[model samples]
Target: MLSLWDSWPLPLETAPPSSCSPPRSSCSARQRSCSCAHSVRPIVPPPATPRASPQYVHNSLGAHAVITNIDVTLRDGGYRNSFNFSPEYALAHARSSVASGFDWVEIGYRKGSSRPELTDGLTAHCDDEYIAAMAREVGPEHIGIMVHPGNLGEHDLDEAWSAGARLLRICFSPSDPRRSLECAQRAVEIGYVVCINVTRISTVAPKRLRRIINAVSGLGVTALYLADSNGSLLPDEVHALVESLISGHELAVGMHAHNHLGLALVNTIRAVDAGATWVDSAVLGMGKGAGNLVAEQWLAYLSQRRAGSDRFDLGSVLELSTRLGESVVEAAPRLDVTDMLLGYFDLSIEHSPRLAEIPDRHAQVRAAGLLAGADS
Candidate 1:
């Protein structure tokens, strides 16, 4: 046989590109279809892969959605002082929220005829003029106002929008969601970014809560916020709830955690891990009963976890939080025995007035358990 080297059509050093190489588009159709090594293109190296931020995966529930932080200091903190937050304090809180990179600041509630005995404070009522001033002071884009489904009327959306309210949060009980849905529909029509808050989520049965969530998600609301009004939810529960709510819905899920068991931060963290995109916190944990998740602490945690990220200015938030302590003598968040009982029994803070009359702490807790059973 002839020498094996003599069988080659071209010398090894001058051989064409390998047959395994892909043909370039510039190659003629005949060349591309042929097995000839001359038709193959030279190999090109791929560009280097970018190094991803280590914290990016942990920042959310394995999703790329940006989480929105909401400051509810003026809105929820008012409960501690009987909704008596002064105009100056409210405006200052809104300013601080904006500076701290908060996405929204809920100034206060819009009063209705249903609860005439609540208080006469501007924050409680969130009168048109007060909202107008806050809108102007903080920029309407960052201003949010809450209203009970019962409190929201047909024309309330128009009034709120005209007064520069960009977001309207409707808080409603899961027992009856019709009114809340109606209000949300109206708000959508009026061009308000509406959030439907499911209050006392722990009290509702699982099936009922799922139905409520499904219904709200189908509506055109901007967000569906679950309110741990009793502060009875644990981290695991929050994770499951948030995960379930986010499974098939494109709607943004939010958490409004109460600090009854001192689990707000952990529960909120779990919610975020389960795809909740919005988080509510109050300065100094000032709110009703055991209070809400503390804003300063929450921001500090985020700042530490998301190192090198400048989304939130923890220093600015802390400064604003300290001012609350200075301005209000009774602004501290307290978790008394009564508050613990409220959380243990899954009783709402709204019933605290009734529980207070029991006189005995043991009896109070027992009464709460009974009340929760009855309410359920």
Candidate 2:
């Protein structure tokens, strides 16, 4: 069996693309047409029994396309506060979210032995105690925890499940894989909403993206999230990715956009318009670097898409972003030249681990950014 932790440069199709794989170039296309599954490889072959003609089922409740917003203020937003949020603040946000009709509230990261050594905040650690504490305040069903693929073990997941994390958002970087699908498989078995977050989607090539997607799409996870890690993707690219992902399955397609280019909202809307059903939003766009799509803004925009959108009360959303979470965004990041250059270069936010040892490293990066007119 091929291990998910195995080295990179996944196998690509030698033959031309056919009806089985519409996008002939994608690594998944070969899996679709199993006629030559093993003509070239020394590894396991594609699913012996075909995928029942690509039905594309889902958990949403509509024949018409709809948008479901997942609030990431606590998770991604944590990057701004070094993964520290007052338990009081987290519960208040959760309560506000329920009132505002948010589909899901991401509470924090679920770090394990694999996390980098740092002064991580309470939520970054997300001990059973923390998760349980958060669960006590908010309905466990309404909360989700974002975790990296390499960091967690079965025990970590078991503890999280016991602590009330019914939704698992596994963030995976194709550059350094950590058995993401295996994690999702575990999450699904535990009766959780499994969301596979393909982080840094723009940085990967189509073949690599397809390979990863193809590998995980069959896992029966609830959704596949494409994260614009560097906030570098344009609206068209967002649309393209959403379209391609939904083309092969009945599962929900989602988008998580960063605001490096000040296009988080635009890119998010484009993805939704292209059939993406799930979207992650931060109140006032309070997240890492330039932050993320504004929940209030995106929800308000989505509310106008159809009548009976009252299920999402913009007034409640407004109050939370302005009142309950206002201070949260008081520190919201601006779209600076450095952020723009990061997007332009399409760099992942993960700086070199070696830089962590250097003191005032953020200052150095900022200095470089300013020199590059990052402040302009």
Candidate 2, which segments miss by more than 4 Å at Cα? Answer: 1-63, 112-115, 175-178, 324-326, 350-376
Residue 214, candidate 1: C-alpha displacement in angstroms? 3.0
Model 1, residue 72: C-alpha shift (Å) = 0.9
In model 2, how large is the Cα lDDT of residue 369?
A: 43
The best candidate by lDDT is: 1
Q: For model 1, how big is the CA root-mean-square deviation? A: 24.0
TM-score between candidate 1 and the true structure? 0.80
Best by TM-score: 1
Give the alpha carbon lDDT tens digit for every residue of 190-220 in model 1: 8889888877776555555555566666567
**Whole-structure CA lDDT of model 2:** 0.67
Model 2: per-residue lDDT, tens digit, 203-310?
455667666776676677878888887787777667766766677765788899999888998998777767888889988787877889988888787667654466
